[model samples]
Target: MVEEVERRKKEILKAIIHEHIFTAEPVGSRTLAKSYELGVSSATIRNEMSDLEELGYLEQPYTSAGRIPSDKAYRFYVDTLINDRENLNLELIKLLNNFNYERQGIQQIMSNMAKMLSSVTRYTSVVSEPQMKKSRIKQIQLIPVEGKRILIVLITNTGIVHNKIVKLKQDLNPRQLGYLNEYLFNNLKDKRIKGINNLVLQELEKRLIKRLDLSQEIIELVYKGLEMVSKEDDFKIYLGGTSYILEQPEFNDLDNLKKVLNILDHEEMLKDLLVTIPNKELEVMIGHENKIEEMKKCSLVFASYTVGDMASGKIGVIGPTRMEYSRVIASVNTVAELMGKIISELSG
Candidate 1:
């Protein structure tokens, strides 16, 4: 008898969640009794909903009204009810498999991934570049562009290329520049980009200045180029389907919409938020689970993707707390895994 009651409660909760996901409306007992084959009367379903609400799985937004699944209910559904082996959309899988990572760069790939996710999930998508702190330098070249300017080209193990222009106070001849390039390549080779900080640059400058009898101006130019390459902003973010958020009922309020727009505008904050999640596993932050104040009313589904062997990045979708968790979770996991595989292949 106890087992039967538990089964009935699960059925009712699943039906409510499914209805709420599509309609974005509160689910009533009558709706469940009519739509779902729960083998119970409206009164019995109402009593079960009351019990579920009292137990914290469902919440009534108003008096004498229908109920909506709370964060707890969503969590229960994701953990216990969702099928882990849900197949990826076949069309999306074909698109992913056909992607040409050789011709298209990583940035383009990330942008397309974000766009694909948004289009499929109908939610805002955010994809970040691989963190450079863990990526080792594969090559460094200093090419003289013109008088008093040089182009510093850096390639990382993850196949990311960074180029910067540095102005030198005094110009150095091609021979001197060649020696400097070789020195930089030898010093930075195999060193993590983030590990090359100002201190390291200063040390390199001091050594080059003393050993080669180079002018302080030329050494400072090299240091400046290295500094630009190692900055935290080396990692970039790409966003897609931002307009989709406006379609959700939760963002119908002007103030709520504005808050989300503001949060999206600040790319650094979004990058920080994605990285601070200690776990690289697929994670769902519902409602108040988000630390950012603007996201308290929203839900975030995110997962990490690897580049090469060491470097990794994050990809996620943001929508109202009433999001379809099963679909969002499956979509995020599939995209993240495909992205990691493509990146690994390209980097190799």
Candidate 2:
């Protein structure tokens, strides 16, 4: 249950959290009274802080006079205080524009994007490659090359084109190639990647071998071509600034630091860490909210980028619990939007 705070207490809580995030130190009531215009005396602010501590919103660290925000407070702040559509970061726009979308392949684009996100946010950034499994095959064409080699061209709805070259026992003429192209497209058009399976291949081969008088080598190569296009290499995580997380004071302890570093070392673990939420909303996982044991002290922010209305992949930021939610949120949202736009344009 979310506990409600009065307007005055809300102001005080906000002031303390903002101060704590800035200094990475437990916030003292005097600092809030002097720095923020809470319209309350230091004594009143101290009393409210005491109440907040009792309510599990704040905690005193090791007999320190000042108090720091608890995970609960961070969750509440993310839920209520931070605005998702905050003002744009102009520097981010300029940096994104620097990407040479026309020259770079998909791998380079995703790598550069990860580096850019980490640079702007000053936190570790993780990105996944664009997923093609959900994309429907728009067309497939077979073209004969030198000797008995045939090149397979596979086009999908997301603008991704895959090319595979296979050698056949017999060379195909123009008429034969034309017939095969039409046959493949008519059967496979608008079919999702999952639709291409062993059963589908068997059905295609049974018809093609009989109709075209195809050699056994040709039939096997045809199945291989289809398999190559439908194969998925999705959810490949790209990491930028793996060492940035080490800069946080929270990970200063050697034991704790080692654990966190191990978490970053595994791509599969990082994949589990950055889960994108539905409805295109920014997902923020505060300290202790994360399921990973080593990530309990960290905060993660994820934003999904779309390709033709489907969530293709995610862009994420990893930082200490003292993360600047407002700034990170803005950067992630802006970059995700730009990536989606570039991908759509590239596909065309």
Candidate 3:
């Protein structure tokens, strides 16, 4: 008898969560009994709902007898009820596979990811550019543009490309430029971007200082060019579908809508929120669980995508706490997984 009662309650709770997710309205026992085959009458479902309310899984809002899933209920649904029932959106996968991963750079890939995720999930998406300190240099090139100006191109193992223009104190002829380029390629190959500080540069300069062919001015210019490549700001946050949040009922209130908008506009805060995820697993932060005041009313579902095991970037969907958790979680996970593969291929 106890087992049967527990099964009935679970069904009732699941029905309420589903109903609320769709309509964004409180669910009543009559509705559940009519819409879902709970195999129990309205009175029985009402009793079960009361039991659930007492158990803190459901709450009666605005004196309405109908109940809505509380945060606890969402926690339960995400942790237990969702299980493995969610399936990846095959169409989304197909669309991603069709993308020209070879031609696009890291920034383009991240932008496309944000756009694709927002379009698919109908939620605002934010993606961070891969952190550079964690990546190693893959290749470097110094192309002479004119007399004293050279274009320095640096590629990281994680597929990020940095370009800088440096003006040298002296001009180099074809053979000298060729030798300098080859020398730089041979020395700085496979070095970490963060590890190339002044001390390291000085050490390299000292080793080559005695070489009659390479002038000190040229060596200093090369050092300056490398510094420029490694000196870019940490990373940027790419956001897409900001307008999607306006469609959610939870943001119907003007105050609530503004708060979310402000949070999104604050790039550093958003990046901090994403970077706090401890691992690559799918994470769900619902309601007050989010530490940021503006985001306390929202829910975030995000996952990290790795770039060849060196660094990881995050992609997330932000929506109201009454989000379709099952669908959002599945979509985020699918995108994160595919993104990791695409980034790996591009970087490799």
Predicted candidate 1 versus true structure: per-residue lDDT over 140-244, tens digit per residue:
998877768989888887777888999877777878888888898998899987688878888888889887857887788677777787666578899999999
Best by lDDT: 1
The 10 consecutive residues of candidate 2 with the worst lDDT sum are: 272-281
- RMSD of candidates 1 onward, in order: 2.4, 4.3, 3.8
lDDT of 2 by residue, 1-348 (tens): 135347777889888888888889999989988999988799989998999999999998888779999999989998998787685567777887776789886667778899999988889998876665767888798888898898888877666677788988888878778888899899989888766789988998889888896687888897797787666653467888888877788888888788778878887666565542333547888889888888888888988888777777788798988888888999999888887888777776
Predictions in order: lDDT: 0.85, 0.81, 0.83
Off by over 4 Å in 2: 1-5, 97-99, 138-186, 194-202, 209-233, 275-279
TM-scores for all predictions: 0.90, 0.80, 0.81
lDDT of 3 by residue, 1-348 (tens): 999999888889999999998999999988998899889999999999999999999988889879888888888888888853376667677777777767887789889989999988889998877776667888888888876898988888877788888888777788877766777788888988778888989988887767537678878887887886776345778898999998998888999999889878888777667765655567888887888788878888988777776546788899987888877888888888788888888777
Worst 10 residues of 1 by lDDT: 272-281
Model 2's alpha-carbon lDDT is: 0.81
Candidate structures ordered by TM-score, highest first = 1, 3, 2
| Candidate 2 or 1, higher TM-score | 1
| C-alpha-based local distance difference test score of model 1 | 0.85
Candidate 3 off by > 4 Å? 141-153, 163-184, 194-233
Ranking by lDDT: 1, 3, 2
